[model samples]
Target: MKAIVIETVKPGGYSIINADDPLVLSVQEGARGETIMFSLDPDNPSLKDNLKKGNMNVTCRDENIIIQKGGWTSIVAKVNEIPITYNGKAPFNIQNAMAAVAATSALGLNEKQIRAGLVSFSPSIGLSPGRMNVIDLDYFKAVIDYGHNPGAIKATGELLPHLSVGRKLRMAAGTGNRRDEDIIEFGVILSRYYDHVVVTETDPRGRPIGVVANLVKQGLLKGGLSEKQISMISDVRVATDTILNMARKGDLVVLQADDVHFIIEYVMEYKNIKKRQLSKEVVNDDHSKEGGQNAG
Candidate 1:
């Protein structure tokens, strides 16, 4: 199998880096019809204007992508019949998947194999965890997500209600100071969804927990959440424990942390710290490779 690294650039964007130049393929039968919209690379300060003006030269290098407009929407593949669609834009997850499909096809995977590769894939943390499992209750629909940035939070918050109907969504959010303003803006945006909102500490390293929590609360308040709708907590363990205890069965529990492994470990440690009985499986992300298990 050829090595291909698909990087998550944003909520709905990714950059595919191929170590070796692969043969491009043409479009073929049974193509999934999904219209995509894309713009010039956001990272390039100049490309946006260049692309808008209909003139730019883009290439893939340095673990990033460079693109100009007006190119055909197809690739020459290892398989003669199938070609991967090149949309100007696609969902970050879908883009990542496409990169994999393209790489696999280049590595001699047939259409059936490429299709199977795409079908067998699922979302993981870092880009988007995709859909989180939450129950439906009389009060609200609870969801848990790993969205820490403003864009991620705003998108998730807005998208929450569309998942189910007839209920207001609650959000519990916090983040570090390096991205505090952005996180605050995200909270402000999320406050619009409030039946309720809680601003709590999330991985508050080298920063005052109280200060961070307050910042998030203030932003949400600024965003239009009633004062009574928001609360601040400095400790995530206590915060989550309290939220989980009070949240109705159907209410969502969204945990936004920068490091997924750390959150998993923290949850486990919190349980053990509280003297709860350890279940049959408990393994950190790395330890799991050694057959370690994490039982909830």
Candidate 2:
């Protein structure tokens, strides 16, 4: 029997829950005959009460995540065991892990299989590209993600504080098609977490070049960031290069990119080329000293 996993609501502007949340209602309705799995959230008592009416077949709760089915409860896995949860620092990811355990348990998967799968899962470029892809260099680290909307930006912002880095730099852009205010909001939200903001253009999607970048710049200015803190580069390649170049040792670059493949390829190539250049410089320096000694 297929089961449903309902994720918990995160904080910030994304946490706005109404009296008749459609997702909650859908979960309630789905519990009529089918097995359903849901995360525990104290804020939504009505949803909890609804689930308590002997409708929900399973539930997942945090703080040493456990999956409960009927009268049987099993410890699925620890939140820290999941790499995506970043050692349980990311609350949203922990909630997601719980939901995954609940759903997989309902699907007849044993605890060992579920634990093994969670441990093996990673959010890498080859696995889950453009969704929190971390690139570690000799000096700095870069995270490329598809955070386009206000809620997504806010979630990323909340996670930034937990990362170990010197300074947080953001290379962000918005589709030219979104509303002016929405585009501006991207910058406004980024200003909270990023030490420096590089505004750029995405696919444009029918709007003129620089329109999206300018809107984001305006939003950054409105969000208390000075012009010096923000830089507008219209070209995606140039913007990517600028951010990579600006990053120093211990710095972190959060890239909210449109063409994720292009960004990844460019960064990899750039790192390789830099290594080659440094090696050549060292070889040339050694040769120059040898020639001077021979001439002397």
List where candidate 1 sits over 4 angstroms from the true fold.
1-92, 102-108, 123-142, 166-173, 258-296
lDDT of 1 by residue, 164-235 (tens): 544444435565645768656766777776566656666566786576677777788788878877766656
TM-score computed on alpha carbons, candidate 2: 0.81
Give the residue spans of candidate 2 off by over 4 A.
1-37, 40-47, 55-62, 281-296
Question: What's the lDDT of the predicted structure labeled candidate 2?
Answer: 0.72
Model 1: lDDT equals: 0.47
lDDT of 2 at 66: 66
lDDT of 2 by residue, 1-296 (tens): 22143233222111111213355455443333333444545234553553465423223346556654344567767777888888877766665666676557656688899999888888798887887777887688889898788877876678876774589999988777788888888778877788899888876788888877888888888888998889889888898899989998899898885787888888789879888988999999999999999999
At residue 184, give the lDDT of candidate 1. Answer: 68
TM-score of predicted structure 1? 0.52
For model 2, name the residue pairs that clash: none
RMSD in angstroms between candidate 2 and the native structure over all alpha carbons: 6.3
